[model samples]
Target chain A: MNAAVEIDVKSEAEAFLIAEARLLDAGRFDEWLALFAEDGFYWVPAAPGQSDPLNHLSILYEDKSVLGMRVRRLGHPRVYSAQPAPRTAHLVGNVTAAPGAEPGVDCEVRSTVMMAEYRPGQAADRRLWAGQQTHKLRRTPEGWRIVLKRVDLIDCDAVHGILAVPI
Target chain B: MPDSIAPDALRRLVLPDRVHRSLYTDPAIFDLEMTRIFGRCWLFLAHESQIRAPGDFVRARLGREDVIVVRARDGRIRALVNRCTHRGAQVCQAERGNTAGFACPYHAWTFGLDGALNSVPHRQSLPPDFDLKDPRLALAAVPRVESYRGFVFGSLAPGGESLVEHLGPIAAVIDNVVDRAPDGEIEQAGGVARQEYRGNWKLHHENANDTLHPGFVHESSVSAARGDPRDYAAPAYDGHQTHTQMLSNGFGVREWQSLSLTGFPAGHSYMGGFYRGGVLSPDRDDPVWREYRARLVARHGEEKTARVLGEDRFNNLLYPNVSINAQYQQIRVVTPLAVDRTRVTAFCFRLKGAPEALFHRAVRFLTNLSSPASMILSDDIEIFERVQGGLANSEPEWLDQSRGLGADRTEAGGRTVSAGLSELPHRAQYAAWLRYMTAAA
Candidate 1:
């Protein structure tokens, strides 16, 4: 009852990440939320290479509760900032996996990505947003889940415009 | 519409109760403000902690000039224009770092931490008549730079009010923030939350003291925090609460009545709505608050510290650029990029000698209340952007600021007192704006 199954960890991981990006880019937040482990972390460090979020400030640091609340706000019609939502796109690649930090998981997925965001922004009427991202993922029994996703912006120190949406 | 900014024409844009929309969207008006307002006023640079070590430097901007705020080898802080005297190229490109000195990338002309010309590359190329001691030869220093406690500020005008004189009543907020620290000092903690908005810089400046829209704009957040976020039928907080919570609004005949809007001379104002006994109560078993309060009692004694700790000031706008929340240990700086674009950077401070818990709590408050994820900030930015968009149109030529006109009463100490939700802050700011816009250069 067993067929030869060739499991390419990198390919699966890449597919998982591409699917995750698709969910986000399409504004399918609820589906994206399902891709996170129960205690997953969505962190955008305030300082470059910042280690801890509790002690230091973060642009976005959310546990399940906070992430849920933000998602809820994003969906609310009266969410003023969301009336005309900031649109974004993600391009994920360089996928690699290592042993998972959790006991009963396959491995952690690491990747390099470039994302562009726009909210009617312009310097000379040019719409743009750019950043690099790192994601730490784990493979569960059913599907891959994100444990930690870190976004490092080129202008991390510069004043930001409407990071209200997920980066 | 005449192109000239004559005294009468400038004054007409700003009335006692309303302001012309062009004032918020005109590039000409923005350029004039760069000269008459920002150039003449004391603008915040960086906290002392930013440049605590000798040779540590952080870049800053005043009006549109790029500046480097550095702590010199002698431990004195200095601000120097980034323009190279040789070819006018920027001498330093980094935002902040520890560096021995800066050397222009274009040419090797170097300057010391104190901004003196340390050396020039290929000095033999220069003529023998060059006078190194000439004031114009070295880095062009800002006309006036001063520090109060740990906050540093700089002014571009050759002659104007002293930093302290310019601070006026707004000075008290800084003092209280530093004085409340158990060690009588505070240090910048965590990183800054840098937010950019598509709106006039003045909108963020005025929003600090504009307390009327919270109930309407932040309605979603209130319900989310307390009830179901999707509870569309839920009414806004309406500044009402249970009997116990009513006391928090202060003398709560009406929530608005509980707040006292005060305006001061030279364009400064505050919205006082902080509950009595302060946002942090000493009675709580919270370890950080307990320890913090004990230290205050030990140094300042019980009775005095109580009033100091129980200070009721909520939002303090230090005219032109900075908004401070001493109670929550926050300092927000607003930078104007263009007529309709601005950036706001916020920092949370740690009260020295307090537990790390206090630092965490401060960070938590900032995250929930002002971080980019915050609905409060989002709503405010949305409104600001909408206002900016609306002002770009000519249909509504004037922004109605007559919310509480003819209701201001002169109080002592150059203060104009008004009831709740009055347009006192806008009035106060416009008065100063007109004076500066019309003053002789």
Candidate 2:
């Protein structure tokens, strides 16, 4: 592809990701939920290439109800972990699109992101969480919906503090 | 003997039914524990299945010391200190991976899977007599490394009971975990969740078998899971018809007193209590339970199956580190970072050859009730932190574990109490802790 054509595709993917990150950062969870297709999957693998969520585990492998509960938990006033609420800032970059396996399917995009979270009462420590994310996008009437969002955390296996909200 | 603890200091800290506050808040005591207790105990390394392939390794912590457990090419597993002897840099930084050999990031000092320093940069610069083949110069292996049914344990101490002997009556609990699988083996599955708690490590150890707190501390969770209409009725233990329901309902003094406590040697103990009302019961007709029951029957026959499955154990505290809840496929390890801070790693296992639903149920149980994010765990953390905070005060000399003391029954190699409300296990743990710490001194 020519440089201009590549830039155009990159801009489009970057815009979609920016909007998604904004919704989450702003705590507009319902708006963020609208960005997923009906059969979309949100996964944070327990380990890399964990194919079966049945036999293996995922930090998160939520289909609708589980995701809904997670979003609900973020707003749970009595959630002791969320008493002061968790603050997060997302820095997303390096969006690259690759050809989809099947024809007519939306392309796959990969990006690197760093999320810094601060939770009061838990600790004074502010952690800079970085990860590589893969998004399987599909063009829908609602612009672009995420078919799959996979997050690979740098410290997934290490001892973790409270993960009160989705990363 | 300043580096060594004084006997009077140790005595003042531990008592029959209560431990002095210093045991939880004193820096000196914490240091002593690192050398005396954790240094000598057969600390859990990693399950053998974690490093099934050659060069596969997992990093584990025995107290403050970090060690790497690697499977060698010849199929022997070795647990060695992660520190590179040349420059004292970590040889392997990754949490886990398969590698031909470990090369230190600092100087590229390479070590074999057996932890022998195989190569160093610019070997020509070294003196002719400088020997690299000496075993002493190799990554210092744990003094003792052994496995019981794939669960690996390491001890820095040179002498002690073997892994099997140390496990005592609790060995059956480990067998129960693996034997639940049709293949009679279980592997660490679904990954592990590590979390830190701002409390003494022993608090988590004690809380594992402290069945009384779950009903009260986890009342919110119990209420949530029990749902709305019955949530009000759930608080009363007497109303629940089944064991599971009553457990979730909240344990009153009378009900808690009815459970059994078995205290084994080496500080291990278990609290036996049925889940009231069967709320936590896996469906009998469920394919997973059917397979598990059949395997148990085949292995131990029908009568033994009843004894295994029907026998209720709320928590099995495995001395200084592990706590196994076999019924739930939950294993929690307490790593003491400091006198006031603890790191708990919880692993939920998948029973090999069992139905998918079985594993999912275990995941639910862990995430909903035991996870750091779980309301129950957070509440317990709050209480533990509060205890740690309260113990920091100068006034209180001892924390009580005196409940049901006079009623404890002496058993072979351990003590057992007929009633669940007994604090025999707590006392037993303190007793064992004193013995281990004092004897080592």
Candidate 3:
């Protein structure tokens, strides 16, 4: 690929990541869900070097269906964890991309995301979650849909308090 | 017991069918519990499979004392106090690994797998009277360490009940878990998922066998799952088991009351299987279940396999710390961190000789139920913290555990059976708590 085309791929990936962060920040989980392909998954591994979500435990390993349940639960009125829904600001940076190995794929986009979550109360709970995200993109006629989005938190193996909102 | 907490005063905190809120809120009481209850109890440490080979070790907590559970070269498992005997620095820092010996970071005081002081940085600098062979110089070993069916437990108290006596009839629960394995063995698979909650450790145990709270506490996930429009008919559908498991929590009042709840005097308790229709149902006739059943039958024969597979119980709480779910092959170990904080570490087991897919399912179950981000446990933890927050007020000095009190009946064994929604488990826990708190020091 020429320099202009390479620059275009990088810019496109950066734009997609920024837009996705905005959707999460705005609590537009439905729109975020739409960004995932039908066969796509969202994984947050518990261990740093965890490879297999099937055989290993993870903080989260949700396919679209499970992620749908999560989204629904987040919206449910009785969801106590989200009673005072946590406000999150996802800051994306350090963008890098590589061409997909398989056919019918665009590129694999990698970035660093630091999500600042604040649960409102007299004694508010504020947490800064920093993680590396790997998003495999597929260039469809409509747009780039995510095939896999993996987040490896800095404290992947640490004993975590309730993660009310996604990082 | 601590000087601040008298035996009589501690005894008063736990009555026949209620306990004082201070038991959950007072830091002094929490300190007493670390010694009187946790110090004396046979707390579940680690599974044998985790330290199968010599030199393999895992870090564990016995009350507030950190210890290294290591298998020595001689094939003996020892729980060594992680502190260096010299300067009290932690000897081992890693969570789990294979190490020949532990070297203190502060001073290179090496301790063997058996916690024997093997070497000092500079022996020549020590006084002539400083004996290296002195027992005081070695890392302290837990007073007693024992294993039952690959489940290792350590007791800080020097001597009390034998491992069998401590387990009482609950030993059968461990047997049921091991016997479910096709090759009559199970290994700890998948990594551990640790979650911290702002509540007393006892809250986790009390809620483990409480059937009535699920409908109210997990209404969010249950209702969401009920409203889910996604198709679940696909064979081997991914994540459907979690959906069904969440739905199981929506059991009706009558249905929750119908299931059996049994509590032992030792504080151990369990509830009869409630997942009757879901993919998590032990009797589900699916490919994975069918394959697992075949493997069990191959080893134990038809009748034995039927007996093994037929046995179904959930959240088998073994007193102060551990809760086991044999059917799902998971265990959650509770560790008290402070008066109002606790940590729970969950691990999944792979049934030997069974299909790998079954283990994968177990992994999924562990994640969905215990992970930090779990939809179910997040609610439970929130309630625990809320309960702690509510207990901060002194208006209601006592909390009730009297549900199904008069209705409970004693069965053939030492077990007390009651309706599924009964708070007998909590009462039984406090009964044991009172006994431990007031016992002669």
Q: In DockQ terms, which candidate is top?
A: 3
Off by over 4 Å in 2: A1-45, A48-52, A61-79, A84-118, A122-155, A165-167, B228-255, B295-301, B364-366, B369-372
- Give the Cα-based TM-score of candidate 1 against the true structure: 0.88
**Ranking, TM-score, top scorer first:** 3, 1, 2
Which residue pairs clash in candidate 1? A160-B194, A160-B196
Of the candidates numbered 2 and 3, which has the greater lDDT value?
3
Q: How high is the lDDT of residue B154 in model 2?
A: 91
Q: Give the candidates in order of lDDT, highest first.
A: 3, 1, 2
The digit string of per-residue lDDT tens for model 2 on B227-292 reads 323333333211121223223545566766666788876888887765543555553454557876
True contacts kept of 3: 0.84
Candidate 3 lDDT over B1-441, as tens digits, reads 475767887777788778999999999889988988888899999999999999999999999989889999999999999899888888887999999799988979888888888888778989989887899999999989999989999999888889899999888889998999888899998999998888999999999889889999999899888988756667534538878878888888988898888888888998885654343585666787888888888899999888877777888999889999888899999999999999999998999998888888899999899888999999999889889989999988999988888988888766789888899889888887888887776
Summarize candidate 1's per-residue lDDT along A29-112 as a digit string, tens digits. 878878878777787776777787767777767665456656766776777776666677888877776666766455666666
What would the DockQ be for model 2? Answer: 0.20
What's the CA error at residue B380 for candidate 1, in Å?
A: 1.7
Clash counts for all predictions: 2, 16, 0
lDDT per model vs. reference: 0.75, 0.74, 0.88
RMSD of 1: 5.1
lDDT of 1: 0.75
